[model samples]
Target chain A: MAGNTTPTDFGNPVINWIDKRLPVFTMMQKEYGVFPTPRNFNYLWNFGAIAMVMLMVMIASGLVLAMHYTADTKLSFNVVERIMRDVDYGWLVRYIHMNGASMFFIAVYVHIFRGLYYGSYKQPRELLWILGVLILLLMMATAFMGYVLPWGQMSFWGATVITNLFSAIPLIGDTIVTWLWGGFSVDNPTLTRFFALHFLLPFVILGVVFLHIAALHVSGSNNPLGIEPKSDKDTVPFSPYYTVKDLFGVCVFLIIYAAFVFYAPNYMGHPDNYTPANPMVTPPHIVPEWYFLPFYAILRSFTIDIVIPFTDIIIISSKLGGVLLMFGSIAMMFILPWLDTSPVRSARFRPLYQKFFWLHLAVCITLGFMGAKPPEGIYTVISQICTFLYFAHYLIVLPLLNKYEKPLPLPPSIHEAILAQKK
Target chain B: MGNPHSHGAQCSHDAPQKHGQEECPDNGHDESKRDFIFISAASMAAVGTGVVAWPFVATLGPAKDTLALSTTEIDLSPIQEGQAVTVMWRGKPVFIRRRTAQDIELARKVDGDATAFNSLRDKQKDTDRVKQSTFGGKEMPQWLVMVGVCTHLGCVPMGQKPTDMRGDFDGWFCPCHGSHYDSAGRIRKGPAPHNLAVPTYTFLSENRIRIG
Candidate 1:
C-alpha cells in the first residue's frame, strides 16, 4: 500500500471489477510501475535484473532437464547422455541450464560487488544484505546438489569430498556423515536425496529473493552516489526507465551466455565428468566448479593441525580447521556491515578503501586460481596467503581503514551529484 | 439490535475468544477452561506436526534395500599373488590383496621402523591389517583385506590394477588426493585422516572369504 499508488480504472469493466477485489494490478503498478528508483545507476546496477532473468532461465531449463534425468546411479549418466543425443532440442535445454549456472553466478557476483561498492549493506539495508547472502548460500546449496544429479565422476567424487567435511566434528561426526550419505558411501541414496534437495532449494532461493526485493523496497535502492534522494529530480519511476534498461542489459548478457552454450558448451565443465561414476576408480584431481574455487582453496589451505602451546594438547585438527575456515569465509558476509564501520557507503568517496577493494578482488582471484591447482607445493602456500588476505580484507583492512582513511565529502543529494558530474 | 443479521459479522469475528462470554459469570472457570483447551490444542497440534514430519525425515536416511547389501563373499582362488582385487560390499569397494613373499617382507620390514610408524596418519600394525588364511592346513598372514576407498574423501585408490602406480610406499595411492598407503594399507602421507579401513572379514576355507 504505497501512498503514491491508487486504484485506477482501465477501459474495461471486467478488469476494474477484478482489481477492486484482488488488487493485484494495483500491486504491480505500485511495485513495478510507479516505484521510485535512483536515476543515476550505472550498467553494474543492471546485474540484479540480469540475475533475475538467469534465475528464470535456470528454473525453466532445469525443470525440463529434471523430466529427462534419472537420479538412479546406474542410469543417471546414461540418461543425461540420452537427453543430449536423443531427445528433441534436449541438448539446447541442457546446455542452457549448464551454462545458466555460470551465467547466474556471473550476474549475482556483479550484483553483489555492486552492492559492496555502493555500501548497500549499511544502515536499514542490513537485513536486505543478509537476505541477499542467504540467497547466495541457498543458490550455492542448490547448485552443489544439482551438480550431483548426473552421477558422473565429478558428481560422485565432489559429493563424497564435500559431504566428508562434516566428519571432522568431534563426536557423532561419523554418524552425521552416515546420515548425510544415507549409507556408508555416496551411492543411490545420496544421489536421490541430492536430486530432491536440488529441486527443493531453488524454490527456497526464490523465496529469499522475494524477501530481498521486499527489503530493498523498504530501504529504497542505493545508487552510485550513495546519497538519499532529496527530491523527485533524484529519482525516476520504475516502469519504462528501468524495465527497458534491464531488458537491454539482459539482451547483452544473453549473447555472451548463448555463445558459451552453443559454441563452447563444455568450457566450464571438467573433462572427467564425462566418465560415469566408478566407485572402484578415482580421478587424479578433484576440483569443484569455478564459482566455488575461492572457498575450495580456503578448504584446502589448513594442512597443519593447531596445537595449544606448551601442553602437547592437540585441539582443532587440520580437517576441522579447514572446514571452519572454508565456512567462515562465507559467514564473514553475514557480519560485514558491522565489520566495516565506515560512514561513507560508496567507495568513490573513500579513496583508500577503494584501493583496498581492488586488492581484495585480486586476493579472491588468486584464491580461485590456486584452488584449481592441487593442494601441494607452491599452490598451498599461495592459497594460504590469499585465504588469509581474503579474511583480512573484511576483518582488518576495512575496520582499520574506517578509522584512518579520510573520506571525501558526500554530495548533498543524488540530484546534486548528477548535476555536478554533468558540469 | 433487533436484527440478528446486523450483528452476524461481529459475532463470527469474535467467536473464538468470546464464545459464551455474554452468558457466563465473572468467575475464572471459563478462563481456566479456555486456557486448558488452548494448551491441549497447541500440544496436540505440535504432536501431530511432529508425527507428520517423522516419515519425511526417515525417508532421507538409508533405505532398506541399500542397507540389505551388507556382506560380500569372494572366491579367493582367482586372486593372484601381489595382485589386489576390488569387490563391491555395501556399495563400497573391498580390496583383497594376495600378498607375495616380497610384499609381506616389505610390509613386515617397516613394522620395526618406529619412526615410520609414528608418521602414519592412522597407525595400525602390519599384523593387524591382515588375517590368517589356510594353505595346506597351515595359517599364513597372506591376504591383506581392507575397504578399497581412500579415507580422505572416499575415492578408491589406484593400486588395484597391475599397471597402476602404488606410490613411493609400494602400497595403494589415492588417485583423488595423494594419500599413500604401505603394503599393509597404513596411511603414510597426504590429506587422508586415516589408514585404508580394514573391514571385518573371515576366511571360510582355503579359497573362500566372507567380507562385511
Candidate 2:
C-alpha cells in the first residue's frame, strides 16, 4: 500500500504540470461558456475550429520529427532512415507529419470552397477571404520546399527543374538562377537555403493564420444563407454549439488520416525517391507532386507554335502556355464574388446557377484528374475540352447567368427557411 | 425577463406582442430542433467519408519491418580496380570505385588543374588524419567511395571525364549546377560547400571489403 501510494505521490508533479500547462477542461468553460459557440452556426462554421486542431496535430508531430531529423544533405536522408528504424515509434511520427500535410490541405481547400460557395468573399468579408488565400499560397510554398529536403532522386531533380524555371525570364534569367543557387548549380547551398526557408515559412504561415482569424472574428461568419444575424434572437453563443460540432468533424477527419498513415504510406510518393539522387541518370519522366499535376498538364497542352509576323518570332511554347493557363485558373478565383452576381446567396434559391455551379465543379475535378494522367492522344484531347469548359464556365456562363436568371424569393429568416421546408 | 411594455393590463390588448411572444418561444425550440437534425446528418456524412479516406491516409507511414533492416552490411569484394558500382545504404546513394593509377596521380597532383583540385588538400589531409587516428592507419584510399549527393540542391553530380569543358578535374560534374570535383571526390569548384561524404568501410582483403 505504501509503495503504490508513494508512486502516486511522485506522479503528482506530472499531473500538476499538465494541469497548469493546458487547463483545457477548465478554460473550455470560462472562455467558451458551457456551450459557447453561436447557436445558429451551421456545419460550414466548423472548418475554422477543425483547422485549429489540425495545426496543433501538425506542429506536435513536426516537433518530434525535428528532434530526430538531420538537416545536412549528406546525412539528412540517412537520418530520416534512422528515425524510421532506430527510434521508437519514429515511423508513426513521420506518418503523422506526412498525412498531416495532406489533411491540412484537404481542410483548407474545403474551407476556401465553402467561402466561395457562400459568397463569403463579398464586401466586409473580402479581406478575411483574401487573408485565407494568402495563407493557402504560403502553405503551398512551404510544402514545396519541404518536399525537396529528403535528398531523394525526385527531391534533387525536382529542385533542379523548379529552380531552372527562373531561367525562363528574359536577359537576367541566368543571373537569377545563379543567385537562387548561391553557386553555379543546385548543391549544398541550395539545400541549406531550402531547409532554412522551409523552417521559416511555416512560422510565417502561422502568423498569417492569426491575421485570418482576427479578420474572421471582426466580420463574423457567413452562414449557409449568406445573411447576417440581425439581433440577439438571430444569434447563438459560439462555445458549446460550435465546439461540439468541430470536435465531431475532427474525430472523423483523424480516422481517415490514420488509415493513410498505417496502410499505404508510399502511395503518394514516387518510387524513384527511394533511390538517392544520381546526376548521371535522369528519370524517364519528370513530374511534380500530384497537387501540381493540373498545372503541369496545362503547361504541356499546347502543341502548335504561334509565330509573330515579320520578326520571325515563335510564341506560345506548350510549356509557357501551360504555365499561363495555370495562373489563369487561380486568378479566376479572385473575381468570383463579382462574377457570381445572382441576387440570392444560397444555391437552393437559384436553380440555373446551381446547375452551372455543379457543372463547373465537375469540370475542375476532371481537369485535375486529366492533369495527373499522361499527355497521350486521348487524355490530351479530353483535358483540352475540360480545360476550355473550366474557363468558359467562369468567364462566359457565370456573367450571362448573373444577368438573366431569376432567383426564388429568400425566406425572411433561418427559422422561416426551416419551417417552410417542413411545410 | 418580463418586458415592461407587456407588463401593464392595458398592454395585454396588443395582438402584435401576444402573437410575437407566442411565436418567439416556438422559434427557439424550432431552431434547436433544426440544428440537431442538420448537425447529425453532417456528422454522419463526415464519418462516412472519413472511413473511406483511411486507406489513403495509412500509406503515409514507413513499412513495419523497415526498422529491422535499417543498418546493412555491404560486401566490397567484386569491385575491380578502375571500376565503380552504386549501392543503397540507409536509403542514400553510395558509390564504390576502385582507384586506378591515373586516378591516384590526378587526385594527388595540385597545380595546373583548371578547376583547382588543390583546394581539397587541407580537407583531404584532415580526413586522412581522422582515419589514421581512428583506425591506426589501417584504412587508406586505394578505393574511393562516397555518397553521390551534391552538397547543394541535392542533385547527383555526373561523373566528369578529364577532358570535360566544365573542368579538367575528373570525378563528377553536376549539370543542374556547374560544381566540379577531383578524382578523389573532393569538391574542387562549384556551389557545393563540402566534399562528398565518405562512408565507413573496411577492407577484408585485396578484393574483399565491408561497409556499414
Candidate 3:
C-alpha cells in the first residue's frame, strides 16, 4: 500500500484499492481522463461523442420497445401501433428509437465527412477509419433490419425488394435468397429471424465501437488542423476540456432530437409503413429511407445490361450491375485512403480538393434526391450521371487532385495556428 | 532433472527469474508432453465450441413448418368473367383471372401472331399461359393463372382489381417500376425482365383449381 505503483491515483481510498486489483479505474483515467487530445477541435469533432450517445439511446429505447413488440407478420404492425397507443410511454420509447436512427446517421455522416475533410484515414489512423466504416456497415444492416420489424407496407416491400437483390447473382442466387427469407417469400419466419438478429446486432455495433475508440486512442484524434499534437501546449487533457465540450455538444443535439421525438415523431417515417404489409398490393413507388437514398439511387441507376459490344455475349445483367455499384459505393469509402493519396492531411491546405469536396457532397445529395424520385424520364438520367460522379469522385477526381493540386502552407502546429489567429 | 511441475524447471513462474532463465516453464523437460496436452486441449475446445455453435446457425434456415409446403385449394366457381382474384399460395399472391371473351380473343390473337409471340420477354405460347378446364360440361380455357408478384422486384401487379391501371397491354401493370404485362401476362415494357411467373396448378373439376 505504501509503494503503490498503480496509475489509479484517485484520492478516494475505495477506488484506489479496487484500481490496484482490477485497474478499471486506471484504464478510464488513462483513456478518457488524462488522455491528451487536440485543443483546437471544432463543433464537427463533437459528432463522434454525439453518435456514441445516440447508440445508447437507440439500445435503451429499442430494448423497451422490443419487450412489447411481436415479430409475427400479422402482429408486428399492430403490435407497433399498440405500443404507440397502449403501452405506457411506449410511444416515447419507440419514437426515440425511430428518430434516434435518423439522429445517429446525422451524427455519423458528419463524423465521417469530418474525417474526410481532415485526412483522418491517413497512415496510422487508417485502421481507426476502417473500424469506423465497419461500424457504419453494421449500423446500416441493423437499421435495415430494425425498419423491417414494424412490418408495414414499406417494410414488407422494402424487405422483399432488397432481399430479391441477392437473386441478381448468376448462380446460387435464388438459393441464397431462399435461405435469407427462410421461406418462399418474406413472411413470418423472415420477420422472426430479422427480429432476433436486429436485437443481437446493436450489441455487435457496440463491440465494434469499443474497438473504434480503442483504435482512435492508439492513433489519437484528428483535429481540424489534421496535424499531430506535438507538445503539451498543443494538447489538452481529455477529461475537462473534451468531456465538457462533448457534453455541451450532446445537450444541444438532444434538444433537436427531442423536438423531433415530441413535436413530429412520425415525420421521418413513411406513411405507407402505417398500413400492415400486404403482399397483394405493392406501394406505387417503392423507395428506401432517407439515409439509404444515395445507395438506392445507385441501385436504380443501372437500367441496361452491360453487353459485349459486337458480340452476342452479355457481360452482366442490369440488376447485377446495379447491385455491384450500390455495394461498390459503400466499398469506395473503405479504399478512400488509397484513393486520395494527397500527402496533406487537411483539405484546407489542399485548395483544389477543398472546392471539389463540396462538389462530391453535392453529387451525393443529388443522388439522394434522385433516389426519392421514380426511376424514370429525367430522374433516371440524372441518377445515372450522379452515380458515375459518385464513383469517379473517389476513383478519378481525388487521385487527380492528389497529383495536381497545389496545397496552401499549413500552420506549424495547432497551438501555433491558434496563436497566429490571435496575432 | 527435477519434476517439470516443480520450481526446479523454473520456466512456468509468473515473473521472470534471474536464475534458471533458460530452463523456464516452456523449456521444461516435459515439453513434448506439455505440447501434446496443449494441442489436444485446444483441439477439443475448438471441436466443443463448433459442436455447441451448430444449433444456433441451423436455426436460421427455413423452419420445419415452412419447409412443409402446403397446397391452396381455390373455389374458382364463384369468380365471374373478367374478375381476377388473388389467393395466397406459399405466402405469395397467386392471380387467378376469369378472362372475358375479349381477353381470350386478344390472348389467342397474340399466340397466333408470329411477331408478337417472338417479342415476349419470356416467349411462352399464350395457350401455354392457360390450362384447359371443364366448365358447364365444355372444355374451356377461360382462366389465366400466374404468380401476382412483379418480376422486377416482387410487387403485386394492379390489374387484379376493376379500378386499377392495366398498362397498355390490358393485362396487368406493376406501378412500382411501370412494368406492363400484356393480357397474356408477358412482360411488355418497363424494368421487369421476365413475364409474370406461371405457377403449377391443376383443375379439380370445372371451376375449382388447386395451386401450389
List, residue by residue over A49-129, the lDDT tens digit for candidate 3: 999999999999998998898888778888998999999888889999999999999999999989988889998888899
Alpha carbon lDDT of residue A21, candidate 2? 53
lDDT of 1 by residue, A1-423 (tens): 635556788767898888877777888878899899999988999999899989999999999999998889989999999999999999999999998999999999989888888899998789999999998999999999999888889998899889988988878888888899999889888888899889988888888989989888888999898877888998999999999999999999999999999999999999989999987677888999999999999988887767687543558866788899999998999999999878799999999988988898889888989889977789988988998899999999988998899999999998888788799
What are the candidates' individual DockQ scores?
Answer: 0.48, 0.03, 0.49
Residue pairs in candidate 3 whose N, alpha carbon or C atoms collide under 3 angstroms: B11-B24, B11-B25, B12-B25
Q: lDDT order of candidates, best first? A: 3, 1, 2
For the candidates in turn, chain A alone yields TM-scores of 0.98, 0.86, 0.98
What order do you get sorting by DockQ, best first?
A: 3, 1, 2
| Candidate 3 docking quality: incorrect, acceptable, medium or high | medium
Q: In model 3, which regions exceed 4 Å deviation?
A: A1-6, A309-314, B1-56, B100-120, B132-141
lDDT of each: 0.85, 0.66, 0.86
* C-alpha lDDT of candidate 2 relative to the true structure: 0.66
> Residue A316: error of model 1 in Å?
2.2
RMSD for all candidates, in order, please: 4.9, 21.2, 5.1
- How would you encode candidate 2's per-residue C-alpha lDDT over A340-408 as one tens digit per residue? 776667676777877877887777677778766655568778878888887898899888978988887
Estimated TM-score per prediction?
A: 0.90, 0.61, 0.88
- Fraction of the reference Cα-Cα interface contacts (below 8 Å) that each candidate reproduces: 0.58, 0.05, 0.58
Number of the top candidate by TM-score?
Answer: 1
Question: Could you say which candidate leads in lDDT?
Answer: 3
Task: Write model 2 residue lDDT over B1-212, tens digit each, in one string.
Answer: 22445344422323335554443333354456667889999999999999999765453323344323344455667766776777666445667776777877776565345345333422553234112322344545656768766554345666633243334476777654445677777766644545777777665554454655
* lDDT measured at residue A410 in model 3 versus the true structure, 0 to 100: 84
